[model samples]
Structure formats: structure tokens, C-alpha cells
Target chain A: MNSSANSTMPIANRTVFFVSDGTGITAETFGHSVLTQFDMKFKQVRLPFIDTLDKAHEAVRKINEAFEKEGARPIVFSTLVKTDLAKVIFASKGMHMDLIQTFVSPLEQELGVKSTHTIGRSHNVADTEEYKNRIEAINFSLAHDDGQSDKNLSTADVILVGVSRSGKTPTSLYLAMQYGIKAANYPLIPEDFERGKLPSCLPAYKHKLFGLSILPERLSEIRNERRPGSKYASLENCRYEVNEAEALMRKEGIRWLSSTAKSIEEISTTILQEIKADVRIY
Target chain B: MNSSANSTMPIANRTVFFVSDGTGITAETFGHSVLTQFDMKFKQVRLPFIDTLDKAHEAVRKINEAFEKEGARPIVFSTLVKTDLAKVIFASKGMHMDLIQTFVSPLEQELGVKSTHTIGRSHNVADTEEYKNRIEAINFSLAHDDGQSDKNLSTADVILVGVSRSGKTPTSLYLAMQYGIKAANYPLIPEDFERGKLPSCLPAYKHKLFGLSILPERLSEIRNERRPGSKYASLENCRYEVNEAEALMRKEGIRWLSSTAKSIEEISTTILQEIKADVRIY
Candidate 1:
């Protein structure tokens, strides 16, 4: 924790570019992960869809301009697939980390094979079946959101049960979007608490159920923002509902996690891990 | 494209670990991106919340077991912040790539400073304000989905106007989740097409509006899956709706993109870039 002593040093501003042939999500995400380990602040720009030579040359110009303006070499993290485009960006006066080039050769040696070297396959609808599944999963998650449908619980890969506003909807959506999992979330309302069990439609599909719990104070705070000064937003009511929901889930042998301290990514990952769901898309 | 010749090679199956002290999202995403460059298949496992020495030791054991079982060293991509925990994982019998250690010192030297070396900062709810905004954005997007409400279009950061299933809902959710942008999606239905305009409430917020279009065949196919043999799912109807919608949007000076071939990530990124929206989350 004493690392804060370094704060006395002046912060340096650096220009960084995430250039890619497709959406640039992989480049930006991987580059940002590397950048987070550094203390220096970055003014980052994304240049996606640089699939053509003209676009690649334009990106090189932009990087060189940044280097000239800053009097320091910029850092370029690129995942361009074409050799010509990659060479164009690498020629810029910057520290270019060609992600695909860095690992593809080693992989070829290990696997005794060559890569496709095609652009946009990582984030494109190149596989028709996978694309259809992703869209179907998204539609399924949306249809099943918030106990809106009881017709397809049996078909869901996982069902997220939780109190209202306990991070169920976003987590379900994220699971669908990233992993192509058919995730359905049902809110635990007062009626479920009064019944001392889950909704009637959920028991048959209990194995697919995962529970989410949030801290009472946090739940109260979140609910207050939506409906201030309402009884539903009361701390006492939140505590009661959460306590009852947890007990019900525990009694039914359902696994649960606290959503208060976690992000949507964390919550969804935990659920996927616990359920041993097949990750259709990485 | 000739890379398919590599398919003749025997695929190597290796165990891969994406270990992190926080959500492991960065580790997984970055690792997956790297792994995609190779033709080898991987059995990937995620070990999140390895913030403690005990958890790190357990991770080491699991990694060693995978190595023993596979008769080859596993590949570990770790983003651990604590030095002690990172050292333990690095000592394992795998090709450990210490993501944080590999870059932190270089950054420290370049900036004439030190990093915070903080745990969980990358994917944690450490910033209460940011977390609150993300949740608020999710709520806003959900409430405004599918022309559900016109209550606060003026406050929205982006309003996506598109025909049904033109990749509106998922893109709106993604913008909300990843960037904390209040994205509202209004589906342009037959009524709007008949009227030759957008929704009545959208004109005042023209600057906030973005449009999505899709290939009529693709739209017809997607609709057919939902409502088979109906007018809404007819190719002629789809073509009419898409053509008219695009014409109306063009007349109104609304920028639009075809969603048929683009991934949700690409569509959302394009919109964000066009609007110059500040990406709040990395």
C-alpha cells in the first residue's frame, strides 16, 4: 500500500493507439490490460476497420503525428492480420506491439501449422451457426428477463434467481452476449418470500438455477435511486427480502453469490464457472 | 485463405489458465486473443479472485496437476497485483506469463515513478461513482428499450432508432454495460414507416438519434424464426420497411449503418466513434 509514495513523482502523459482490422476490441482490451499495469496516463485512440492499405497508411500518419506532437514515441498495439498492413503500422516511429505477429509464429512451430491470417474472424460473423446461436441466446435472454416468461425455463442453460435490482438482468445479458449462453433471470418478489420458496415454475428446473444476493444496504441504496422513499426501497424491507431469499435458496440447495461486491463480469463468470456451462464463445 | 492447409496437422490440446486477483476478464480476453492466433485447441480454465496467498498456492497446485495430466506444461496468463501471490503462481510448473510483472517495471522506469500495484482495481467496484453510473445506465437502457418510454429522451447520451431486430437491443445494452452510456433504442415499426418519420418525441432529440439498418433478406430470415409465414416476416415486407426506414432517416439527416454483416461490438463501436462519446470504462 506504500506504493502511493510514488505519487510524488510527476505523471507523464503518453499517446497510445489500438489499431485493428476489425472491431479493435481485442487490441484495445489486451492493450488496456497491459497499460493498466503502468502508472502513466494514456490518451488512447482507437482506429478500427483498418483492413485496407489506405486506411493503414492513414493510421500510420496519425501515430507519427502523435509522436511529433509529444516529442516521444507513441505505443501502438495492433492486431492487424494482413502482413502489408501490419508492416505499414510497424514502420511508424513508435513502440509497435504486433499482437498477431508476436504469437503466430511460435504457435505455428508448436502446432506444426499456419494460421488463417484473415481479418475480422475473431469478432465477425464468419461462422453462420455461431452467429445464429448468439442472436438466439440474446433473444432468449431478453424474453426470459425478469420472470417475463415461464414457457422456456426447462430449455435455459442457466437461470439466475435474485431479488429485484440485484444485478440479474445485466449479468444475464452479458452471459448471453459473451458466451452465447441461454440465461434467464427471475426476480424474487414478496410473493415468493411469502410462499417460502421459489416460483412454482422454477422447481422443475432447479438444477439450472443460480442465485444472486446483494447487501441489504446496497440493495436499499439501489432501490432508493429508482423509487425514493418507497416502502420497497426501505432498508428494513430490503434486509427482510434478502434474508428470506437467501434462506429459501439455501434450503433448496441452490448456489448463490453476493453481487454487491462484484461487477457484472465477475458475477457472470462466477455463474458460468459454477454451472460448468460450455462457453460457446470466448 | 490458404491457411486451411494447416488443418491437416494434428491439433495440440493444452490446458490454459487465465488467472487474476479480480474478475479475470482482462486475463481471459487477452489470453484468448493470443491463443486465437494459433491453430492449436485449448482447454481453458479461469481462476478469478486469487488475491490471497492461499488461493495462489491452490492455483499453482491445479496448474501443476494439469501439467502432469497433459504431460506438457500448461500456459498460464496471470494478472496478479500482489508480488507474493504472483511469485507463487510464477513458481508453478507451467509457462507462466506474469502480465503485470512483465510491464510494470518498464512503466515505472518510463514515468520515473511506481505503480499502485493495487488488487481488484481493474474490474472491481472500487469507484462507487462509476459503478453507480453503470447501474443507472443499465436501468435507463432497459426502461427505454423497444419504444417502451419517451419519458427522458433528452437526457439520453444516444438514442438508437432502427427497425425491429436490426441489432438495436443488444447494442444498446452493450453501450450501457461497457461505456456507461445511457442508450435508448426505439424500434421503427410499420406505423412509423407509414407516417414517413420517426417517433413523435424523437425529433426534438435529433442530435441524440442514431439509426440502424439491415439487409432485407437477413431481417426477413430473423423475423421468420419468430413469426413464421406472417406478413412481418415476409421478404417483401422486410424490404419495404428497410428501404422506407433508410430513406426517412436519410431525409432527416440521421446517420445509419447496416447491421447485417457487423458484429454487435462493431456496430456499437462505430456509433460511439461517430458520436465522439467518451468511453467511460476500459
Candidate 2:
């Protein structure tokens, strides 16, 4: 239950940020950044959609319920939501939890503009004329690279191979977009796990082989989010699986990178560097 | 090419950032974040390898060259590669740039604890046991959703259909990771243009379709990055292609999203909310 935070306090005292516009990640990104910068200990909950006025009011009720259940105070960080809805939700629930609406006040002050009822984070870039195509290219490359059932691995400028749950995809996409490398990634799935060997497609390109290993407990927690009660998410199995995977990687002499806690930017760049691949120019 | 910063500046005056330690992305992440936050533009370059002492020395020489050429005072935010090599490099260079070594400074100042000489940014989240695995799952899902070959459109929780260079991949990854939704993307390649219809795979899943359109000049610039001198990357071609693609999408009654200046997070979430698909729990 994330006992890392004090659970006994009232909702108002403890900051509980339930960040979301109509979309969750946008709100979460800003909320996480601000939270990290301030070193504030807060419980973060993402409730993605609250687009309508009714849904916004409903969210307040849900927040109050969660606070009452936890016996703690809460603070909220909401982003890019409609002002009216945000006002209603914050006003109705402010007595219980302090709500920080991230985008509105500053945005309004800066541009003398309230959003034209738009629903997401504003794109602040140097070149709007060029950003669109870059975004589209990113989309094209992403759609083209799904590692499952794709046989054209040869076309990839770089290929990432890791056991299931190792950091490969984000690394690949980041490389593709940031540096314009045609990166492809394939998972070392359960079948490979059963064989106790790297997948067949890997060894031929072992020179480019990179592995991502993580600690078992972290794996368990992340897996728990996906499948809460299954043996697949069990800590014991995770430990065994991780140990076995690392051993196989070492025996195969496939150079590996540990992804435990490393962000996408770190993992991707590290893999590219270890492989000594050409510097991607975008 | 980027002749902005100069050398002969004091240690603190020069802002230098080295993006290496094998993972250029990690280095870039730290550099970009710090640089952006400070709004201090300086001479910046990425030296991707400093794994050995010799390589470290070579890196110093390259830095000297950049300093000499730019003539603008420099500052550095370097990723001091491996443990042994970092010590050697630091001793040789004697702390030149603004020199914010992410790993070293934090350990020394924050905990009054010194590191036992480790390489890379794994320490940022090094203690997380399952860090590698969670990253792997994200990468795997990212690979699977690439718009090109994941032809089983039926399984897509959301499918982004757009002209070439539309913001599809980032949007897909954002949806999958932030929302846990399996988003698939399909590009409107040139063949689709010649055929005068949407790709056959798209019509079957039209109900889940969302389109992304970009400003033509932005398309031109992105294409120029890929094929610098080609007519395909020409402004005229971009204009023609964009107009034709939009017409096709409009004719088909597919609700399209304009990706002119939207960040990937914004684009992805906006589409997810617009489609009202079931948000994935992760």
C-alpha cells in the first residue's frame, strides 16, 4: 500500500495529486516534474478522463472517498482541464484536499489567453513549422517497428534484444525520433526462457545484442500493476527468472545493459553507445 | 556547424555538457533538462564514448577543438563515463566546463558518501529491483504497435491513421505506456496516394480510426532530414501530398487530428479521449 508516505493524516494535510487532463500522462508529466523539484511527499493518483462538467464533479467525490478510506489529507495537481469543471471540482473538494490546477493561472497570465476550450498541454517549441512533420515521422517509425511477427529485422539500423520487461521499446523509439535511427526491438519471450537460450534471431546479430536486467522486486511491483493476483507477478518467480536470464546473457557473451531505474533516454543512448553504432544525425 | 559558444572562459563561466557514458540519450536527457531549465545556451557537443582512459584523453582533445573553433566561452555538463576513466579524465582536464557530473556531484554532496567508482547513470534508479523489466514491457509494447506491420488491426484499442510523417509513433507509445492501451498506427504511404483510397487494413477498423495531419512546410523539413536532396522532400511535394491525404481522410469521414504543433503526449491523449477507448490501467 505504498507505506512510504504517512497514511494516518487527514486529506488536507497530506498532498495527494490526482493529475489528469482528459488524459492522464500529460497531467502526470507536469505533476511528477513539479513534485520531484519540490521534494514534496505526495500520493499520486491518475484519473484520466474528467472532460465534462459532470465527470469533473464525480472525480471530486472519488477523491474524497479515497481520502476518507486512507485516513489522510490530499493535494491534487490537475492539468489542461476545462476551467469551469476545475473550479467546480476544486471548490467542492477544497475543504478536504488542496487542488493545484497546473496550467491555468500561469498560462492565462503569460498569454492573456485562456485556452480556447482545448484539452491538452501546449506545445512550446522553437519551430512550429517543422515540428509537425517530425511528429509524423515519429509516428510512422513507431507504427513500423512492432517487434512481434516482424521478419524484416535487417532493415533496422539498430536492434534491441532483451527479456520481457527489460527497457527496449522506449529506448528504440527515442533513438528513432531524437537521432533518426531506424531502431527495432524484439523481446526475449517465455519461449526463449523455456529453451534457456537467446532467441535464434539474436545470435546472428549478437554483435548488436544488448541486454536490460532489472531487480526482481521492482519487476514484481510493475507486473502487479498489469496482472494483480497472478503467479506471473510473484516475487519468487521474478527472482528466478531474472537470475536465469542474466546467467544466459553472460554465457552467451551478449553485452547487456541494466535497465533497473534508468529512464528511457538513458537506456536507449547507452545501448547505442555500447554497440558503437554510427551517431544518428537528425 | 553550431558556432555559438567560445573557450578561454572561466570554469564556471563555460557551460559544457558531455553526453556519453555509452548512452548518449542519458547524457542528452540530463543535459537537455538542465540546459532547458537554466535557459543558458552554450557550446554543446556529444562525445558518445569514453569507456577507456585513452578514449577519455581523446575526448579532452575534441573538447579543446570545439572550444577553439567556437571562440564563445564554454561550460560543460559531461557524463564522466566509467569510474577509472572518469578519474583519469577529470585529473587530466581539471574540471573545465560548468561540469555537472550527474553521478559524482550528487553522491559527494547529498549523502556525504562517496561512490566506489561506478560507471553510468544506473544509480539514478539503481536500487529499484524490477526497473529493467518494467522498461522492457514498455519497449515491447512500443515495438508491437509500430504502424507499419502490426497488420492485425482488429486487436488495436486505437489505430492512428495518417499521411506519411504524421505524429503516429509517439502517440501510439504514449497511449500504450501511459494508458496501457494497445495503439497501432498505419501510415498513408505513397502507394495509398496512388491508389486513391485508404489502406485496406484501415477500413475494417474505421470505427477506431483517428487521423493526424501536419503543416506542409513541417513535412518538408522532416523529409529533408531523411532525404536531403530528394524531390520527395521538396516543399511542393509536401504541399501536394498533404492536400491529397487530407482529402482522402475527409472523404472517408475519418475524424482527424491536426498535429501541427502538438507534443506527442498531447496528441496521444487527445486522440484517446476523442475516441473514448477503454484506458489501460498501467
Candidate 3:
């Protein structure tokens, strides 16, 4: 039955290009994400660092080649900052979706000013202090990962407490990298459950703490992959840990959420929103 | 001088909305990145989880309100999958940039097939193995950070070596998070400089190694922020460490790049391109 169903499905045979004046990361990210909404698959080509007029012309030629070979107008998603360069690509046979120009003019008129019209300044290292803060946040998170250090608990903006395999590490790193937040995560262990309280180091910083709980089945599956056929991977153990952790969080009046159904982006965004952190820098 | 210059600069007064049926992270990221190319700022609003027609109408109402108040057509970047929902926003006074529809039609014609027209599948947790791989990569990178663990030396896809504060940790973490590459970073300390060779554990995995170097002045500045008025933070010391680290990398025939001026994204992209890693999953 599965083979028959698969045979009836149509195959994808289109080409797509992400053209940019800089790293092309933004074009590719936005383009791929939008493409995923459709069932069609694409052969994606990235043309990065197209800063010069000559490079832009070369990109147009390549795009035209794809158009001719495929007998279809290939799609082009571009973030080109220069108007002249964007015009060159816009003239190509492909259908152009200019990300920057489509919005920049309206923004300029609304602000009653002109744009900088610069290339590669969006994610560049133009500001030193922002870069320093990102690095410092990364370092702080690393030092305090898995309850490794106790020196700077007071300095942390948010201390994530959760059971093992409950996804505290990735969420912490994402918070730091994306929003420059100083986040530290500590794993709640069986000892903490026996003690019937939070960790000793967390009492002074209870207001800054956030909790993550996972479904018992999902937690058991994740733990089983790490250490197979162990008591730590047992379903009964996972259920007990999750229950105790939730109870402790509710007793402490701390905010908590389930990591079982959410992605890292969702988890981090929810934490930032719940904690009322300033997320404008992102 | 700074206060006088700041007073002359105009503040931005435009409102921008990122409307989507999912997390809206892609719309926000692409919109904000493109907006940064211009000098004008915006009051940004994100309306996510808009999966129904009623919710879509609410978004259109909100967008039109912004337009009426500002007396300008606000910019709307949307990734809504449903045509009816997207059309509702398109009819608003705001300038609507339908990210998915702008390209999906060309792609459909090119492929001679119809799209699945699914919602919320781009970054969803529909597949278990992909999530497991991401978590495993994060765990591996964390365990091997700063040469802390030698147990998984053979399992790493890339090992980053550099002097302290050359951005090995953040780059490693970014690679793991974005591309699911198993990355480990080792700090090249003074003891390694005294011996004048690569670390003992790195000799067997020479082909899998990448090096990060930074400007001496920048390195000194970064170190000084951590430990002020120490020999380790001296410019002369920083120069010695960076020079020796570069020499060691060259002698070992390893690829290296300076992280002084590049963003973490740029550095990671360069390494991925040079190493020929399969980064298409991103």
C-alpha cells in the first residue's frame, strides 16, 4: 500500500536561486523557509558576495542559464542593497522577489529620511559593545552549563532549572546567541527530588528562575537513547521526576512550560516574553 | 560632540508587522534584517499563530489601524500559507509582501506539480530523528568545549583550535545548532606555546581541525575585560599567543581564518565552505 501511494505522488523538478550582495544567509533562510510551506522541492543555488556590478551581471547570466535549461522562469529571492545591482538581477528572465527594495522605500518615506543604502551592514561587526556582550553571555552560559559553576548566579538574567533531557541547554544557548541574554541552566537530579526542594544555589535567585517540564514518555525515549536499558531511562522514573519537578515549581510560584511540544525557538521566545526581557536587540 | 550629533538625528515613527500562521520567526528575521539596511527604525509587531480565517481578519484590522494612525501604508511581511488568509491581509491599506505566494506559483509551474499547501511544517517537530540529532550535537559540543573532554575526539566533524577569545566557542556552538555539525573547540594556552606544537590529542585528527586567529589589539581588549591589569591581558602577550597559534596551524597544514572582523555567522559559513560540509539542511 505504501509503495502504491508513493508511486502516485508527483516529483519536483524546479531550480531556485538565492542571490545576495553579502553572505546570502538571509536570502537562503527566508527562501528555504517559505519553500518548505509548499510540497515542491527545489534545487537551490546560493550566489553570495555579489557586491560588484560585474558579479551582479554574472549572477544574471547564471540565472538566465537556469531559465533556459529548465524551460521555465526560475525563482530568485534577493536581498541586494544596491539599486543598480538589484536592477540588473530584476532584468533577468527569472521572477525576482526583491526583499530589500520592496520595503525600504516605504520605510524611508515614513521616517522622512534617506537610507544608508550600504551592503553587508545588517549582521556585520559594526558595533563593538554588542559583540562583546554576545561573547560574554556565551562564556557565562558555558561556565554555568549543567550546574558546573556557582560563582556568578547573581549575575544571570535567567536561571533555567529542569530535569535531565528536558532541553535546558539549547534553549539557554539560543537565548544568549539570539538576544544577548545571560542564561544559565542547571539540571535537577534525583538528589534534589529526595530533598523535596530546589537546589541550594537557587534559593537566593528564585525570582529569576524558569522551569521546563517534559512528557514522561518523551523524556524516557530521549534518555533511553543516551543510556539504554537503565533505571534512568525507565518510564516510571521519568514520570516520578516530571511530577516532582512540577510540584516543586508550583510550590515555589515559579513560571514553567513544557518542552515536549515546542521547538527551541518557541521555548526561548516564551521564556523571554514571560520574564518580560527586553528583546528589541533581536 | 556625541550629544550634539545625537540630537540632530531623527527618530523613526513607522510601524511594521510580521504576520504568519506559524511561529513568525522567519518573517521577523528576514524583515528585521532587511530593515537594518536602511537607517530608519520601526515599531515592529509580530502576529504569529494565525492559523484561522477569523484570526487573519483580526490581523487585517490591526494592520489597518496602524495605517490610519500613521497616515502611511505600513509594511507587512507575511508567510501565511493559506490564500484566503493572505488575501485578507493583502486587501488592507498596508503594503503586503506575501513571501510564500510570490514564489510558490512560479515553482509550481516549473515543477508541473501542485504544492501541499501545508501549514506550520517549516520548523515543526514532526520528525523525531532530526530533533535527536540536534540535541546530540549540542551535547557533544558542550562536552568537548575548551578541550574539557577527550572521550569523543574521533566522533567530531570539526575541531576548532584557537587562542583564548578568538571566538571558537560561539562558532562551534553556531555550527552545531544551525547545521548539526559535531564541533569541538580547544583553547591554545601558554603551555602549548612553550611546547611549540599541537596538542597531544589533536595529532590523530589533523584533517578534521580548523583554527581561529584574531587581531592582537582586539584580543588584548577582549582579555582585559575579563581580567584587567594582568600579564595575560597585555598586548605583547596577546601578540605572542596569536602569532604562535597561526604558525602552529600553518605548520600543521590546517585551514584557519581571523575572527577579528567577521561575525559568528560569517566565520561559520567560511569554515563550512572550506571544509566541504553538507550544510544544505540549514
Chain A structural similarity (TM-score) per candidate?
Answer: 0.93, 0.50, 0.92
User: What is the descending DockQ order?
Assistant: 1, 3, 2
| Docking quality (DockQ) for each candidate | 0.36, 0.09, 0.32
**Model 2 bad stretches (over 4 Å):** A1-27, A30-74, A78-92, A95-123, A126-170, A174-282, B1-38, B41-147, B190-196, B229-231, B277-282
Which candidate achieves the best TM-score against the true structure?
A: 1
Candidate with better lDDT, 1 vs 2 = 1
RMSD of 2: 11.7
> Which candidate model has the greater TM-score, 1 or 3?
1
How do the residues A105-224 of candidate 1 rate in per-residue lDDT, one tens digit apiece? 665565466776778656665234655666688889999999999986788999999999898998898888777789999999999888887899999999899999999999999899
Q: Estimate candidate 3's alpha-carbon lDDT, on a 0 to 1 scale.
A: 0.78
Model 3's CAPRI class is acceptable
Q: lDDT at B89 for candidate 2?
A: 54
Off by over 4 Å in 1: A1-12, A38-41, A126-128, A278-282, B1-11, B91-93, B278-282
- What DockQ would you assign to candidate 2? 0.09
TM-scores, each model vs. reference: 0.90, 0.48, 0.89
Top-DockQ candidate index: 1
Give the worst 10-residue stretch by lDDT in candidate 2 chain B.
B1-10
lDDT of 2 by residue, A50-155 (tens): 7777777787777777668756534455553456876766764432221123323442343233434445322334243334444443544454444654465565
Error of 2 at B87 (Å): 27
Q: Rate the local accuracy (lDDT) of all candidates.
A: 0.79, 0.55, 0.78
Write one digit per residue (lDDT tens) for candidate 2, span B114-189: 4334344332332333334334434544544435465455766777877666667676765654444667777886
